[model samples]
Target chain A: MASPMSITALASDTIINAGAVDYLILAVYFVFVLGIGVMASRGVSDSVDFFLSGRSLPAWVTGLAFISANLGAVEIMGMSANGAEYGLPSVHYFWIGAIPAMLFLGVVMMPFYYGSKVRSVPEFMKRRFGTGAHLVNAISFAVAQLLIAGINLYLLGSIVHALLGWPLWVALIVAAAIVLSYITLGGLKAAIYNEVLQFFVIVAALTPLTIIGLRKVGGWGGLTDKITSAAVKNGTSAGDQLNSWPGNDISGFSSDLLSVVGIVFGLGFVLSFGYWTTNFVEVQRAMASDSIASGRKTPVIGAFPKMFIPFITIVPGMIAAVSVSEIIEVKAGGSVPGGSSGKGVAYNDALLYLMRDVLPNGLLGLAIAGLLAAFMAGMAANISAFNTVVSYDLVQEYLVKDRDDSFYLLVGRIATVAATVIAIFTASLAGNFSNIMDYLQTLFGFFNAPLFATFILGMFWKRMTATAGWVGLVAGTGSAILVWALTSFGNPWTLPGQGSAFLAASVAFVVDILLSIVVSLMTAPKTSAELNGLVYSETPREDLVDANEASHPWYQRTIPLAGIALVIVVILNILF
Target chain B: MSVNTTQKQHTAGILDIRNVIGALLGIYGVILTLMGLFGDTETDKTDGINANLWAGLIMLAVGIFFVAWVRVKPVVVPEDLDTGGDDPAYMEKH
Candidate 1:
């Protein structure tokens, strides 16, 4: 084990010699990503192609891109930080939270969206609810997208600053500029292609790191002993509190059996269902699939690979905790330093400390690159999505109408630039917050969660009125803000319970849904023809031909394969 | 429009089962790996290795079940009314 200061010094020394090589590798990576964008631009002859990759992407490509987009820099840092702080409990985000949600969205919600043939989630909102609902959805989504972009930039800057002694703004600007250049030139195509490259680079780097880290700490037995010893000294045990099962501590289940049930049924189901079904970022990926069947399977296919992320991302943190515990104990007189009440090491800093001390030089460079890939993938996705929605949903809808293909393409480029600048500025302004990942999630939850609720209701319930969508959108968002403000008062709102603010916003959303239904019943029901148009577009006769073709039996074959995955998950849970 | 509704219904049912099984197998792989990495040796390293054994057995069974199910289940034609394109095969004959 090494002291924090000593570890930092070692990391700095190793990185200094490799600075030129690091920069060269990164430059080449940047140019490669940019080249993909340039090639992708060639396909951008129409608004549809620019926004949706000409809707010809294969199922696997869409699935891969979808997962890659969600795999942002913040997620990597956040997951690593979580692994460091909570041991295995961080797996909840992927397993109990993200995977099931993705599957549900693909199977249930995708059919509706693809069947309707809408370009953007907001456009679908207009059809399902009305103009006012569309406006609200667009505004809220834009805010969330901007915040996500800013957070990614901020994290990228922080990591560079921590590792290389570079100024935060300098790192932020460089990352943003590189990502923005590709996104501006190529739109979703560039983002997808670059994301694919990033996905490979990140996996290649992190997989070996996890293995080496475990070996460094002398295998599983040695790792456990170290952690158990550390935990006993710290007055705790590594159990469900550390592991992310259904009854995990972070799910707010503390000795009350009823609370655990409520968390599983209410929070777990609702949050996962809401995100998978309604999130624009996730939905955008599904929308890019070549066909409805492919769209449905894309998420399911994506989930197979995604299930293993905790191994690569979370395990390293646990290894780090075991390795670093001895140093922290010595430094703080048997107490961990910088954690909540000196119980553990600071979660975000834990992995970095481990990397600095444990990893050799060349391996260290690879790890850094892996982390950078995570950041780039995340940032690039945000910038691309932000530019697309702004250009297609807002600019095309409100500012300009009846535009030519080239005109729309130009608008996309301008939106990309504007979005990049805004994100960079916001990143610079956000001062150092404890656990940068949590700060970003909190900001996103404030804006996006309520919007997600509204979209879910709008899509599923036919009785949901435009008036209800507006009321819910405004009231839900407003309540979240008010709660956030009130919680911040008297103190800086650092308390863990402050996250309950999302609950208030969620309540407002439910109320809005109920009100909308009552209002719609009292008022006139939309005509059947109008409702049909809103829900289902004319199924192109050509699609019927392909649907009838027998060329691709593999698509049909994957159905049962997906079933095997589910049974295996349940059996594992019972057995493990 | 003349496609067998009953067959489509059966296909949907099989698809649902397939999806569940696939998710289970995928999740099982993850859990098995985690347990192997994080299992407490002191409690059940030698005497009560049933937990580890059960995990492995369950994973194998579920995986086998999924493979067997996929092998046995009849393939149904995908309803592809969404792959709209200029591809000649997809073109409607007048």
Candidate 2:
């Protein structure tokens, strides 16, 4: 069933050939999503309502949106493809990489963020590092959002064109209009609600496919049995398909990239911490909850569902490796672990093939709709974050200070439209990257690795000066670029893409911490009064043990709940 | 998850939008699912499987649950805090 055309064309052809029911499913999703936007728009009176959802979200809604916002269609597609290629090891991204960091965000950092009451993540930078560092963070963040959003739009348009055979531009325009309409009108609250709905849609869509696929493969034992047989038949090591710990031998993953050390230290610590803790894209939802306690619990609540996602996404990919015959086999070479030497699927078309080959028409339509919703949710989240940072941190705080609240609100709306348009234009340029997940992870390393360092020191150590923050950020980014160049330009010593990113991020983080410490020791520290509520030790926003909270059972507390999550993750790693 | 009892009687905050969207999608999902299952003209697009029926039921369950949640726990605004429109808590000074 694979198309004999270009990689992009094959995906479009698959979607274009989908049944009519799929189209109807998509149409309903579009109408309902737009309706939510219109409804959300009715109460917007100022910037706060638009940007922060009026600080009225409950923990459940915020939690779902927080994870859904990160659960972009690209993530689904990329991770699934990784599953097909790498097998069981890919599950590590979920179990080990994501859960711990999310819990850390909620249990440790939320007090500082919610207590200080900064509007945007970069605004937090301004509070901790002063104007110069804030500008660096705000400007970098704005650029990153645009790039990521543009990538999402490009992917959505490509998927629609692949599935429906419509012109890519038509799909792009329609998607852009729908996202812009709802996001511009409803703002963050509308975006949050829609994301929660999208999460349900995605679960509903993929779960059936996983069940059906599992049944066909004869359950877990059957799946492993078939993949192992295929790998052996194809002149590949079955170990590659079965093992989570890529072994020490040359036949396993290249030593630089697929080691447990790389995954644990580089990904679990530096990369995951940087992306989850500091990046505004995910943090904005947490900051929007009704109370500090609820706000703090957002990410911890999100981590539960996050742990289960690999079952729906990665499992299907593993099934595809053995079940989908059209997966184009490639000649084994560097970094390409031995898999069936038959045909290999387009690295990105794994999920599209699953829907096309596995799902029936009616269910396929719903699945397509869910995936569509996922795409929109991802775009909307980015656009909302972009608008918030641009309008508040960049414009309202610096350029147009003292503008009436209504004026800033209008500016936010305008910025939303402008950012969407810019993303539309940039989407056309997004076809260069081959693997979306790897590319994004690399990008995170580039900017956020150093930023996370700054956040860690700034929040915990009062002696960390503003100049130190700026210097560390610059040095960190510079180090990341240097490491990336060494790897990409074929310096014989560097690791694979993930390894390079892992090493660079680790290097940048260490550099940032050391540089900041040295610089802070030499520079004048901000006074105790100025540092109040900003640093960890001197903050007044610390809530003394709430009598109400204390009275509740220990299981209900955030720490205990997080403890439960940690235990569950540990058990899953051992089992899987 | 307890609803705030201090809210005004008729504030828009009473209606949780999650319920509304959930209910709408769920209802439509059920209709399409039924059409796939009961309608004689249903095509064997999913290898003779009733995919529509299953998907619709899922949506129906999701919709019913959201609607039920809203009915069970209507969100209310806190009486003590401003609705947060143009309020100082929301607005930041340079």
Candidate 3:
């Protein structure tokens, strides 16, 4: 988000003038956030206890945490913004882009992560492909977390700036310190516990806003009618705004068939799979569960909540598009003269303006607190993941090998502080963007897509060599960057939504697979013994599962749960 | 029993996620309900109903349900149990 950083105003105008009750409610929420950290700290006696919660959390706890960890600024604000701009095609992000890949992670990929027992994703890479690939993965993963965390931190500061009429630097420092205290005090346990609490708070805040917004428009019928007419004014049809399928407007393809292909192949398969399966922010929650079964069920349990998230997130954005005057003005090729950013009205302002328009004093405070919790959850996920990669993968592996458990635990705490401080600097780098989803999608293309290509191919194909791993990742990332460079920056081609991002990811995935095959053919592969638990064909079935697996109920099992979720998602798609 | 003191049961359930969620929602519920009754309801801001009161009552009900759930099924934290190390031999031995 900060790449083309040229704007100076962190925030010029305040969006929410929170009253005393709003402040009290927000205060209570913070106390609980800190309290969770304190309680979680009681459980931490060793490095494992700090880094992985000693893998002590139950499936349900981890499952909720898994989803909560993701209910951050990106999912809430970014999706709402998408909904405001793209309309119903935005649900494609939740349904087509996320659910299948999440299920795939639970049923197919999680066993390897749990069975192999790596603290981080980069550590998993090291066990499979050796030093070359592990080093590349660890560095890139660490860098990516820092950059994303900055985005979350900046948004959090913006929320604070909106609440009180505080300066951006003061708000940034205060918000960073609050997050830093919790992560450093209790490590991953604190972060996960806070995330679970934050999730419920987020739901409680947004559900009313959505229902009230719908009420303001009369009902769902009224909302659809209003937005439908508004779409005509905006020069797009009702189908373009309301329907999710064959979305030519979303995929940046002039033709409907090409748009569907671009959406299904690019966003759904490569980018979604890359983020869910390989990204350690999500994977860490699953890894913290007590057993392999619990770990596997983590994502499966989350899929239930995840599939319905767009209702609260994107629906409110759609509501704002019709109801909020500033949002409407921006939609019809105009800008708010004195918008919050001091630039103009952006799609990101949809939720905030809608809150102002509909919510009264008490509920307004709850909504503001909910937004704060979300931004904190997002930042905590990034910082926690960063510290893990730093202490366990980078520090232990290369810099300070053969350290005592206590020493490494200390290193984790220090890394948490370092990340928060660094994020404060990078937080300023992100200028006001019209829609943040474009930047996020582009980042995922550059990082996660290539990494997913490497992991998926290497895990299935026993013939893939160690050298091919690093070569494929580097080449794939470079290609995605090149593709993005050619398309953006005053280029001839213009993508409607996140088409360039999708194109970059698809190109990266194809390039990585092809290059891995070529490189693996030239290089000698690792022996079957070395690839045992890492590769699917070489490992026995028993090595990848809970040995006492049959005792649990059907709901507790991964296969049955994922199957049920997939069916429900299919029904949702048809109904919508 | 001494080892399980970190997860002390009879005291305030601060560590438990359900309790935290329930208690937080419960407090907000009470506040909003009180506000609905005594303070400004702002019926015009919402449709015609007292939104704070209705939403507050609903939140209170859900919060109490969670508290009752914790009572029905207390989460037992396994203390000082031997953790399964990453060694393949330990897994194979089982």
TM-score for each model? 0.76, 0.90, 0.94
Residues A1-576, candidate 2, lDDT per residue (tens digit)? 001112232232343256666677777777778888887777565678789887777777899998999898878887877778777777777776788889999888877887788898898999888988899999988987887788788778877766766688888899999999998888998899889888887888888788777777788899999887877777777786577665223112276345777777777888788888988978999988876766777998999999999999989888777676545342122233212111234645667666666776667777778888888888999899999998899888878898788888888889999999998977765654435533553565468889989998898999999899899999988888787768766668555436666678888889999999999999999988887767878775335222344555775567888999999999888876
The regions of model 2 sitting more than 4 angstroms off are A1-16, A246-258, A328-345, A432-441, A544-548, A553-555, B1-7, B11-15, B39-49, B78-94
DockQ values, each candidate: 0.03, 0.28, 0.30
Best-to-worst order by TM-score is 3, 2, 1
What candidate 3 gets wrong by more than 4 Å, as runs, is: A1-11, A431-441, A490-494, B1-13, B81-94
Candidate 1 CAPRI category = incorrect
* Arranged by DockQ, best first: 3, 2, 1
lDDT of 3 by residue, A41-99 (tens): 77677888788877767777788888888778667877888889888888888888888
In terms of lDDT, the best-performing candidate is 3
Clashing pairs in 3: none
Q: How accurate locally is residue B25 in candidate 1, as Cα lDDT from 0 to 100?
A: 40
Model 1 lDDT per residue over A306-410, tens place = 777777877877777776654445322454433311233355555666656554333345457667767777777777677677877888889898877678878
| Native contacts matched by each model | 0.00, 0.26, 0.34
Task: Give the worst 10-residue stretch by lDDT in candidate 3 chain A.
Answer: A1-10
Chain B TM-score, structure 3: 0.70
Q: What share of the true interface contacts does candidate 2 keep?
A: 0.26
